[model samples]
Target: MYRYDQYDHLIVRERIAQYRDQVARRLNDELTEEEFLPLRLQNGLYMQRHAYMLRIAVPYGLLSSAQMRMFAHIARKYDRGYGHFTTRQNIQFNWIELEQTPDILADLASVEMHAIQTSGNCIRNITTDEFAGVAADEIMDPRPFAEILRQWSTFHPEFIALPRKFKVAINGAVEDRAAIAIHDIGLTLTHNEAGEAGFKFMAGGGMGRTPIIGSVIRDFLPWQHLLTYTEAVMRVYNSYGRRDNKYKARIKILLKALGVEEFARLVEEEWQDLKDGPETLTREEYDRVAAYFAAPAYAALDNIDPLAAHADSKPFANWLQRNVKPHKVPGYAAVVLSLKKTGVPPGDATAEQIDFVADLADKFSFGELRVTHEQNLVLADVKQADLFEVWTLAKSKGLATPNIGLLTDIISCPGGDFCSLANAKSIPIAAAIAERFDNLDFQHDIGDIELNISGCINACGHHHVGSIGVLGVDKDGSEWYQVSIGGAQGNDSAIGKIIGPSFSGGQMPEVIDRLLQVYVRNRVEGERFVETAQRLGIAPFKEHVYATPISKGELVGEDHA
Candidate 1:
């Protein structure tokens, strides 16, 4: 993890002081809501339906055990006894008091953390693959570049008030776990023909109301010019992106209107002037940042036989199968703590759970933990020998759901329960679906299905890329849900297609059941839900979900890719 320098600490402390005064003014009525809105948003504070929500940035999803303890303290003392981990690798504290947010931020600053750039029209948190340095297939660690971008973008005057919030994601692994295709600016780190490290740049991708995958603007860019080229791209967007309508303000909309070729041409023209400026990355800077993310020390040990160790326990075997992932180290595995337990909203961790996990991280993972973009926590370096003990502890704390990529490992936002922008509640929908597919055997048979729910088209839950997407809609002042299918994340990411008309919230579980039934019936041997859906178009599933009163023969006839 990157530690803050004296300068870093000084800047955060100053920002906290400034925000403290600003918040005091708002509470004292010296500043109206309109005047305080931007001020508060820049500090990552939002006025939700019931109370304020404070978003805290967990840079590149890395958290030290100390930082995790601070989060636990905040949840226990300031907000309610819980915090919500979000899909962007950040955490949210609902039920915040405006007067207390500065104090919360001060505490975060004490731990080398803050809420900077988590909200507002400025460039939001720069995210990367959660498995960045540890993944076996990684070409290079992407966190150094991610941290470089974070330092460059923080309060940059040119980009402070862009047309809309901008997001950047980098993927360094052979598999694109960062969902690079869906970010405003996506970078895939790779080596060129000459064996020099560089990037493949994709721009204008986003998923709000208009979901579009980004197009490649540069097939290859040298590592040295990374920041300069990024600056050029942002300059073009900041200058020409739409300002008329909030709905059409994202860079994706700009790319659509300008065409990818023209957008690339403009970025190229802008880069010609700024390619070798002072902003060009230097060897020393790269080395300095890369050193911070170096791998931790590990004891030399042979790989343990998990099967032999847990021979008598099916529960341990099940957890090992679902929750544990392969680690690059010989005697270690990465364990995902599923926050999507049935009946609980996805990603909600109580203060007690947080503290327990912090202790677990200290005892098992070198006092470090990671937050995944899928709304889960990861103890990324747990020893294989201690797997049973870790599992037992997690189970005691209600963290051992053993459904990392399964249907019940849902990704969802705090919908109508917290956000005023939500049209309906998403937590209940997630719970309903989790309950519908509660059987572990049944869920495993379903096989690696991502069910994402969003309360509205803002797509915070990333519904556009789920294998089964449930989106809440407002229809005639009542809650309705529109289902989409065949979507996927990773290198082969694709936006899902809407099945048909929206269904009532009460019908969601049944609709999901019918869709899964369609999948199970039509699937060939060893086929996953997504593969089956892709093989047989959305017609069969649509027919089953909507109950169109069509014959099986008619559905078969319509199932053409």
Candidate 2:
């Protein structure tokens, strides 16, 4: 939780004034829709199918309880009664009024938050693991570096109008919870043989028209040169990335055209003049940023099995197993507040739910919480002794579904319902799958699955890396769903392969059921669905899904794969 300085406050206030004038001009007919497009996009405002959508940045997914309460207020006053959390750990309001946007921005600014860089063809929000500072497996805390990048990249003149939107993610843990492999620029905090901290830098990774896992550009970049090296990569991209077609403009496309070796060479050549320059991070600067993320005070206590007393309570035991994660500190845990309730849209929270979560964070988690890229919220420092109390309160609010990493814990985008770019509605399909596997016993039996749904190929829902991916496509003016298998996130991330012909939306539940059956039949003991699919390849699952013949009317489109 980085506090805003006087300069930070001044910057936000000035931006709010500028945007207010811009909105007024648009409303007064002084600026036409064409003229207002980029201006509004710079502030994270979008003209959707039905109304405007506003995306607010939650940097590195960190939020204070006070800020969460502000979000609740905005949800209640500005746009409908709820807001949708996104895969990037940002939040969106679907129904926004054109004239009220400035007021909303002002409200956000009051809380040291803004919509800046949430959209536009510039560097977007920098993201990382939700459990960054507290993960037991972390080699180092990455938030300081993430914050440094945030400060450096915001409104950088060189990158204000890049070829396409750029995303960066960093992971400090052994597990790749941040999905570093699928970002434009990915960094993993590591140590050299001498045990000095540095980063394993990768570039040219992205998902969209073309999905690519980033290639490691530098095995060990010294920590001090983080900014200089990053600027070098951006300089290479900004210089040669395509400008002719928006579809081919991402750095990944450019990297593919020119081989990785050439890209690395170019970056190194650019780094020669910039390395060890004034932009090199000093130890004092690192300490100043790191101070903001220092651990909260804790009483002397020993680790205890909080679940021992709840052995007879199946609900409590199940929740403990699924929603609670181990903490780096003794007698503490990180608790996930599930947003994947069966009837609700994935990652959405109502105003009351938002307020309730804020209260819970204050009471249980040092007045702070982190938003997971999986569309859940984490109370990163809850006492293990208070697990049952936290669970009880969250369950009453429909925020404790006990489905983390399970089939029911789906990651989905606001599809045709809110986004004009979507091909089909994503919410209903996600609901169908969640309802089908509503039984906790069944989901647990399936074991640690990442099911992602996207309305289109943009991969906002990250379907490309799901254990099972559902993508919405338009076929002959009708909405159809495509299923893919063997996709996974983390260190060994891979894009999923389409199983066969696309099926109608109505057939999705059964299609998923069939895929799971193949996994169950072929899997050896202790293997997860993705591992089993990898071991057997896509042939068995494809055969199982298409085994039962159907009428020609049921098929929507032939598999492009």
Candidate 3:
């Protein structure tokens, strides 16, 4: 993890002071809600259903153990003892008083963390693959470049406000876990034929009212030209991106309106002007940034029997098998701390659990924690020797759920409970599905299933990326749930299909169960749920969910099978 340098410290402190004054002015009625809205959002604070929600940025989804403990401290002391990790790899604290947000910001600053750029229509958080440095398939660590982008975009005068929100994700791994195609700007770092590092640029991708995968506008953008090329991309977008209507304001709509070739030509024209500017990253600066993200030294360990460890019904072994993945280092495994426990809301980690995870990270793994873009926490460099110990400590805190990549490991948003835009509750639906799939072995057997839940169609829950997506819709005055199937995340990103008409909240679990059961029965041997779905399409699962009879008092669509 990069420790904040003097320049970093000074700028962040100044920003915090500025936001504090802005918040104070708003509370004193000096600024109207309309005027304060953007300012507050820029600081990662939102006026929500019950109270203000404060989103804390975890840069590149990386946090030190000390930072994690500070988060737990703030959650316990100021707000409720709970925080919600988000799909964008940030954490949100609900129930915060608007006036107290500045204090929270100050506390976050103490740990070299702040929520700036987490929201509003500027370049938001620069995200990357969850397993950036240590993934076996990674060509290089993407965080250094992510950090470069973060610094370049933070309060950059020209792009303070755009026509609409913009996002950027980078991945160096052959497997794209960052959902690069679904970002406003996506960069995949790879080596060129001459063995020089570079980025492949994709533009006009986003998810919201409209969902479209990004197009590769520029390939082989040299390493030194990252900032300049991106500056060109942003300048083109800022100049020509739509601003007429909020719905039509996204860069995706603009790119769609202009053909990809024309868009690429425009960006090229813009880049030609800004190609050799001061913004271009020099070899020295690149090395300086990369130095901060070099992997920590790990002690060598002997590999033991991989199967014999599971004989004693080691509760942690089940979790390790499902959630942990092989590390580039031979004796280590990347540990995923799943927040999707049955009956508990997805991505909700209490203060105690947060503290426990932080402690576990220090004791068994590196003294760092990573909040993944998929709304889960990761201990990225745990040695294989320490897996059992880490699992026990995690199990003690109810964080040992083994349902990773399964139907139960749902991704949910702070739906009606917090988001004013949401039509219904999301937590309960996620809980219901998780409980239904509580049978651990069954969930593992299902394998690599993604179940996403959103309170509404805003798609904050990443419904567009789930194998089974649950979207909340309002009919008249009641809440109804819609299901989408066949979506996937990772290197192959695809939007889900709406299975049928919406169902009442009560029918959600059974419908999900039926969907999974259909998959279980129809899938050929050794086929993953996603592959099975692709082979057969949503027809089979959709048929079963629609055909199944529901209990009395449950709402069903008129066109039921």
User: Which regions of candidate 3 are displaced past 4 Å?
Assistant: 306-310, 552-561
Q: lDDT by residue for model 1 over 1-561, one digit each (tens)? A: 899988788889999999999989989999999999999998999999889999999988999999999999999999879999999999999989988999999999889999988998889998888778877688989999999999989989999999999999999989999999999999999998899999999998889799998899999999899999999989999989989999999999989899999998999999999988899999999999999988899889788887796699988899999999887778988899999888778999999999999999999999999999999999989889999999999999999998889989999988877889999888877877788789999988888999999999999999999999989899999888889998888888889999999877667777888999998898998988988888798888877776653222110111100
Off by over 4 Å in 1: 548-561
RMSD, each candidate, Å? 5.0, 3.1, 3.4
Residue-level lDDT of model 3, residues 140-245, one tens digit each, is 8999999999998988889988998888999999999899998989999998899999999999887767878889998889988999888888888899887889
Clashing pairs in 1: none
Residue 42's lDDT within candidate 2 is 95
Task: Locate the minimum summed-lDDT window of 10 residues in model 3.
Answer: 552-561
Task: Name the lDDT of candidate 2.
Answer: 0.91
By lDDT, the candidates rank as 2, 1, 3
Which ten-residue region of model 2 has the weakest summed lDDT? 552-561
Q: TM-scores for all candidates?
A: 0.97, 0.98, 0.96
How far out, in Å, is residue 260 in model 3? 1.2
**TM-score of model 3 (CA atoms):** 0.96
Q: How much lDDT does each candidate structure score?
A: 0.89, 0.91, 0.84
User: Which pairs of residues have clashing backbones in candidate 3?
Assistant: none
- Model 2 residue 175 CA deviation (Å) reads 0.9
Q: For model 2, how does the per-residue alpha-carbon lDDT over 211-254 read when each residue is reduced to its tens digit?
A: 88889989999999999999999999999999999999999998
